[model samples]
Target: MTDSHDASSGAFDPASATIAVVTYNRSGLLTRLLTSISEMDPKPGHVVIVDNASSDDTGEVVESFRDRIGTTIVYRRLETNTGGSGGFSEGVRVAYELGSEWIWLMDDDVEVIGDGLAKMGRWAPRFRSIQGRRYDFDGSEFYWQYRIAERMGIPIPFAPAGFDESGYKPMNSGCFEGMFIHRDIVRQIGLPDPRFFIYWDDQLYGWLASRKTQSVIVDEFVLRRTREIKQWDMGIRHMNASSNAYRYYIMRNRAIMKKYYRALGVYQPVLFGLGTSLTFGKELIRLLFVERTVRGTSNLWRGLRDGRAISRDASFRTMAPLTESVD
Candidate 1:
């Protein structure tokens, strides 16, 4: 689908709109993402790539695109791996500082269907309506988060069938990979809490933002990518379950989230903590007794206990770096 706008009138140019992408060691994936951005319509005013201390040649790959892409490509490399929350927080800060009026935050692995920026540009005026695209990993099953929402009968605001045009209503926070946030909203709500480190950071940001502003989903634009699932348990071994890193962050940040929610008079955090404990406990039993990883179970038990602690720091060095090639 194509959108037309008169160049002389500057109708489609939403001043200061930028695309912010966060990457960690996935040089190949970053290259493909840059190519995708190069092909986007109504070209973004700027493109910022936050490289989280990759040991790979990610810097060279980004440098190769200096000429072809229309928007200014600003590459900022961090000194260490700070995970998604920190990377995204820095990316948004950079984009906003670079005068971006609207920021499109995306993961390195995501692929735009076609003219994604132009679609966003044409739709940018409706900044109050934050939109995200449907994501399908492996081009088969939808992401587990979406499936879980469907199972829970939670009304997905951006289903293909369309939703009530009642402006913005509160809904569960979706993944950050395919989401676009208005600059004004981010300015008000601030960046994702860095203490989160990983899981549920997007949820906290979305839920907090929704209280003051309306966020919606754009059903038309779809972002597709191949997700690598490393099986540590049995079902699907995505990043969250494969490494001890996942358990640590899940426990620590969950406690933090519970604290924040309780402070805000939201009672759902207790249920959330219970659900996480039960789910991880089952995984521990399977990995320990069935898979014979007694050490893994011990680590998980510690994680669950520490997760409930209000003052515990979850950061730790694991066996391997919590990253994989995007290809």
Candidate 2:
């Protein structure tokens, strides 16, 4: 898991790659992430840091690393906080505009091991996008359910067993941390959606990308997350223990889920509709017995109503690509 690599087995141009990291007010964690990235072997050709109008010392941290890091670090600060979706959109647009052959992306808190990028760079040309394994803060493997539910086209939380480490598994989903994608895929699917504002954006984009080409989740590369893991019933872990606002997005994006199913076939929507009803009942029970929040019931009703209405509306617009408005 160090700098050791056997590129003779599969060599790729490391210089043709660019990295896009989106950050908010997490300057302290960003320092560690950037440091690890700076130390990556055959470093990315360019490193783009999209700061979403952070109020902290993120700018100063970037400046300090500018001279210290071994790569060309480009820091772009937005005037407002546009969330992860917006930040990644603008960052990727910039990377694409800069003419990079491959674009690697991550959040502010991930630490990239040198060998991960080296391995991903070697396989950059093979797939549309490649995802590396992520380790939790406790050094345990994270994102246990890497498999996207074949019927629903959503990630289901289940760990796979007995996979060959040397081979790749077909993936219809993606995580920003340690995700490596070719520029051509960007041309086909466009940049990641900013209007998603946060949750489900990556999955939607991953779905779109996979529709046009092949993407894979492989263990050849790796990334480690530094966060507290939250677990739920039935071996379920909320890798992202989201907030009320995030919950809103989670519910609202069901429209996106509906849209995805509707595109597949006539029966998919019917199946998904039935499945959603069951899920809604389970959620209501969870809120009643487990959560019991003061306004949880009202909020749940509002979210479900709005989400379904959003999906049913005729004017619902898919998130437009930031690259389309690139200046």
Candidate 3:
């Protein structure tokens, strides 16, 4: 699907763009993601891969594709796993250091399905932040994103729908996969908060990006969602029910997000905290009746309690070397 926006003063040059792919222990999946990049119609000029201290052979997998992606590959492995938030933060930082006017951020599990990056490259110059569309495992549009609460920093569910593939619709927030953000926006708002550890990191960053400049979720498919699709209804689901760690982080991060929204100068603490508590209740019910996991239940309870304290003294760290010398 080819969508076009009016050309701005500066036309796009592939050489000015850097693609950041963050991966964990999934070597095979990372290979497919990099392979897809190698096959893009107009490939990125530079690619940066950040490994999240995986026990698997992630380094060898990256080395195997070093010469074939048709770009300069700068691979860096973190000393430990800092979740998706840290990986993307480091990846974007390295891309900026290596000279990138535009940074395209995504995870390694997805595969580029079309000439969408080339299309984004053509349109990105006109806007500060650009988000491409994504499809699920069933080739259905991944519809859980695009609607973010402006005041509360929470993700709200809308009626499932599709978008017209011809316009760049305005958005309050978006996900990391297929996100085309400008260097200036990063300089202005700062990098994705690493303190988030995982959940709410991208949404908070996207919300900040929207505040500073023109950001939109374009109606164009770029990445095909490779992760398992959840059976969710109105955002009511088990929420990684088997994984107590995910429940803990997402629950704990909700309080962190509340503080972030407050700092953003658009927050109503009482209303937002109430709404967040209600959302937490849904996950609790799912954790109990749906998953029947005793451990998840305890994690959920502690998360709710600990999250309050977390909000009381929340802090966000920006990436160092905030401004790149490359223009």
Candidate 4:
């Protein structure tokens, strides 16, 4: 749990990896995250904390760890709150420019478990992009389904009763939390699109990575959620009750998502439309029954209106690759 990894140990030196975290005003949560990183076995050599123009004491919180964490702490504060998408976009770019061979992306709300980096690094030889599992606040495994319904553009929760003998499953979608990616993939795919201010940006970024290499979610447990969210317990799984801002973005981002699907030659308007409608109905039910409030419905409707405009807009585009050519 110290900054004592030997460079000659292997290709995945842990020093070659950089941890990029996007944080807002969660100063307390950020502190916990940094503490965990400081304690990680074969800890990353660099940590980039992107502050989304937090009006709170986030800057001071980061400053406190300048020399204490035993790793290079690069703190970059944005001029405005660009949400997770922008924060991560900036963080990953900074890490890449620093010449990091691998970038580990996550939010401030989670803490890395013991030797998480070491476990993730073990697969670097075989996979360029990999993901590790997480434990919820109550000690339950976080839901990280493997596949994506490409045609419908939704995550599919299908997997074997247990992890395969190989201890990982192929994944088309990516979670910003615990997504460990190699620099080659980043150069090929560019950065996470800042256009998606919040929701679904990671999915597209992950899907893009999978297009280039064999992206998979390993069975290794790497993170733990520090906060407990209010969720509606369905018989099968629990649905987290989201904020109005999240509700709005979730509805609005469908248009941006469609642009990517369209570019990939898999845009099925009828199926996508049907899926969106079902999502709308499901959210309405969640807002009414779970949250017991009708306030966020306005955001959902407004999101639909704005989403339509985005879909119709000829100017909106997907993230362009940084490299000259990509497979």
Candidate with best lDDT = 4
Q: Per-residue lDDT tens digits of candidate 4, residues 1-327?
A: 011123213567889999999999999999999999888888898999999999999999899988888899999999999999999999889988888889999999999997999999898877888999999999998886667777777777444436868998888889998899988788878989998999989988998888888888998999999988999877567778888998899889989999998987889999888768877887898898789998889998989899999999998778887763322
lDDT of 3 by residue, 12-88 (tens): 88788898989999998898898888898787889899999989998998889888888889989999998999988
User: Poorest 10 consecutive residues of model 4 by lDDT?
Assistant: 1-10
For model 4, the superposed segments whose C-alpha errors exceed 4 Å read 1-10, 157-161, 324-327
lDDT of 1 by residue, 1-327 (tens): 111112112345644677788899898888888887777765778888999999999999999998998678999999988899889888878887776667778889877666676666655555443555544555643433321231111223233333456433334464678667665566656666666778667766666556555455554454667455443433443322345665566555656666555555664644555656555665565555444565655556676677666544444311111111111
- Reference-based TM-score, model 1: 0.75
Query: Which stretch of 10 consecutive residues in model 2 shows the poorest summed lDDT?
Result: 1-10
In model 1, where do residues sit more than 4 Å from their true spots? 1-15, 127-129, 144-170, 230-241, 268-273, 278-295, 311-327
Per-residue error for 199 in candidate 1, Å, reads: 1.2
Model 2, stretches more than 4 Å misplaced?
A: 1-11, 159-161, 233-240, 260-267, 275-298, 319-327
Looking at model 4, residue 153 earns an lDDT score of 70
Question: Would you estimate the TM-scores of all the predictions?
Answer: 0.75, 0.84, 0.87, 0.93
The candidate 1 region of ten consecutive residues with least summed lDDT is 318-327
lDDT scores of the candidates, listed in order: 0.62, 0.72, 0.75, 0.86
* TM-score of structure candidate 3: 0.87
Query: Which prediction has more favorable lDDT, 1 or 4?
Result: 4
